[model samples]
Target: MPRFHLVSDPDDPVVAPFRAIKERDLVGREGLFIAEGETVLRAFTRDAPQRVVSLLIDPKRREKLADVFAGLPEFTPIYLAEQGVLDAIAGFHLHRGILAVGRKPPAVAARDLLASLPARAMVLVLCGIANHDNMGGIYRNAAAFGADAIVLDADCCDPLYRKAIRVSVGAVLSVPTARLSRDESIADLLDATGFEGLALSPSADEILATLKPAARTAVLLGTEGPGLSPDVMARARRIGIPMANSFDSLNVATTSGIVLHHLRFLGG
Candidate 1:
């Protein structure tokens, strides 16, 4: 069992990283991100244990999380506090009584991540996806469908945001991710990486169900309101999900789930 340090005072510097969690969530300190709830923490423990820096728990829930604590590194500090103290420190009522701080690994180049994939691979490419919730949901879907990796353009929101990590149930930790350079175009990168780019758009020449999957496929998705940019759509083979009664669109996350699920079982 890791040693539990009692943190009674909300102002304790040891727990400062967690102070005003909601307000400072987007501001990661020294590449560290906050992981909330037991489910996300468990995923982190199983998938990225080395990234865990420390943990904070309500004293009443300590015994309940013994297995979790036992899995951490010996040097990891586990801070215990009463519920009220914990709530005060976080600036909200943390019903789960569990929170962890984790570090992000060094950024991997998009080309390098793509180059490392096997011949048979499915990749999800996001362009201008600014909503963190949608980003997290897409990552969860990618993991579920066994996507090789996710490549995000510079415009996408940070997947490491606390709510996104919580919403994804920690899929962000498990799936390999890379960001595109400012000068890179999503279509050109896919082409150079030897992937057949399929851009999902409402107006497209081909229906998604009609196209055969390639040995290496990269599905391109865009922001909710604008969809893919004109340049991006022009560069790739445009495909659309068929809807009845002229219903043209779905949420970007939901569309990704449906498209990824279809591609997962597509025999090359």
Candidate 2:
């Protein structure tokens, strides 16, 4: 079991990283990230325990969380605080009373991630996806439907952002994710790997369900309002979901689930 430490003061030097976490997360935390709530904590500890740096929790729940502590590395610090002290440290009311500091793993090349996939693979390529909630939701879809990996352009939001990780229910922790460098074309690498790009667009001539699934496929999605730019869509074939009442678009995350579901069980 990891040793537990007592911390009554919010300004304690050891707790500095947890102070004003919201602001630090937005500005970037030097490769570290904050994970909140019980479910998110469980996912991190179970899937990526090596990434954990430390944890801060309310004392009242220690008994219930004994197993979680037991699973951590021997040197990992577990800090205890009363609920009020926890609130003061977080600079806001923290009802869940469970938080962890985790380190982001080093960047992996996009080609490296794609090359590791199985022969028949399905992946999601995200372009200009700046919303954390949507980023999280899409990851959840990717995990649920067995997407082999996720690739993003430089314009996408960080999937490790606290809210995005929480909203994804830790799917981001499980999925193999990588982002394209500024000059890299998402299409070139995908084509080189023999993966067909299926860009999601409302103006496309082909409806989504009508097409045959490719042996290796990448479903490309973009931001809500503007959708995919022609250049970014590149040489990919465009596909669209037919909606009732002439709705031209659906939320990107929702569209991912629909598209992935069809591709997964039906062949894509």
Candidate 3:
């Protein structure tokens, strides 16, 4: 069992990392992120145990989380605070009554991550995906469809953001990920790694359903308003999902689910 530290003071130094969470959320907390809710905490413990730094909980909710606590390392600190104190410390109401501060793992380069995949692999590549909700949705979809990994450009929002983690229900922890440097060409990297890069575009003549899965495949998705950049579209094999009644576009997350689901069943 982990040692339980009782916290009554809102300004306690031990829980300082969690102070004014909303304000901290905007700037982010360096390499550390808040994992809120029992579901997300469970995912963190199960998927990325080593990254867990410490946990804070409402004393009343402690009994309900016995199973989850059993999986945590003995060295991890567990802090129990009353709901009022917890709210004051967090600067917001935390109804779920469970939170964990976790550290981000060392990043893997896009090329290195791709090279480490199996002979047959499917990867989700994101360009300029700034919204945390969309990022989380894409990760959730990727995990559900058995994607080998996810690659994000440097401009993409941090997947470890608390809202994104909760939106994905911990998929951000489970999915393997790599980030591309600003100077790195996402297209060039995927092509060089022997991945057939399929760029999703509304204007493409080829239908996504008609394409066969390659030995190694990377599905490239872009931000909301403007789709993939012209440069990416030029280098990648452009494909589109067929739509009726002239519906030309879908949200990137929804599109990812459809494409990944289709690709999952395709014979390589």
Candidate 4:
């Protein structure tokens, strides 16, 4: 079991890094990110224990998550606090009473990630998806539907954002993610990697249920409002989800679930 340090004072030097969490959350934290709640903590310690810089949790969860805590490296720093101190350090009510500083894995180029996929793989490609909630939901859907990898263009939000990780129920930590550089086009990467693209757009002519997906397929989606760009749509066979007589669209994250579900389990 890892050693536990009890910290009653929120201003303690050892816990300095966790102070004023909310105000600084959106700002960059170098290469580290804060993973909140129990589920994400489990993933952080289990899947990438080395990346977990430290942890702070209320005494309430110390015993409850004993196995998780026990699995940490002997040198890993674990701080224990009461509920009040926990909230004080976070600058808000942290109902879950769990948090950890995690080092992000090294960035992988889009070309390298896509080229490394197996012959029969499903990939989720995001273009300009800026919302953290949407990023989280899409990651959850991708994990549920067995997406081999996810490719995000430069405009997308960081999937490692704390809220995104919580909303995804820790799926972001487990999913294989690759990001495209600023000047790179999603179409260029797909074409070079031999991934048959299926751009999701409301104006598309091909019905989603009718097409037979290729062994290596990429489901491309854009931000909810503008959808995929004309150039991106042209690179792949455009496909659409049938709408009702009046309704024209769905949320981008919801669309991911519907499209990825069909591609993995239903008629593609």
Choose the strongest candidate by lDDT. Answer: 3
> What TM-score does structure 3 among the candidates reach?
0.97
The better-scoring model by TM-score among 2 and 3 is: 3
Q: How many backbone clashes does candidate 3 have?
A: 0
lDDT of 3 by residue, 95-174 (tens): 98888999988888888889999999999999999999999999999989999999998889999998999999999998
Error of 1 at 169 (Å): 1.0
lDDT of 4 at 244: 93
Query: How well is each residue in 1-268 modelled by candidate 1, as lDDT tens digits?
Result: 5678999999999998888998897556678999999899999988988899889998888878888888888878999999999999999998989999999978999988998999989999998888889989999999898999999998888899988887788999999999997798877788788998888876777887767878889999888778778888888877878788977779889999988878877534
Candidate 2 per-residue lDDT, tens place, 139-174, comes to: 999989989999989999999999999989988888
lDDT of 4 by residue, 145-212 (tens): 88999999888999988899998888898889998888898888888999999987677788888768
User: TM-scores for all candidates?
Assistant: 0.95, 0.96, 0.97, 0.95
Point out where model 3 deviates above 4 Å: none
lDDT of 4 at 61: 89
Q: Per-residue lDDT for 29 in model 2?
A: 91
| Residue 114, model 3: Cα distance from true site in angstroms | 0.6
- Give the CA lDDT, 0 to 100, for residue 156 in model 1: 88
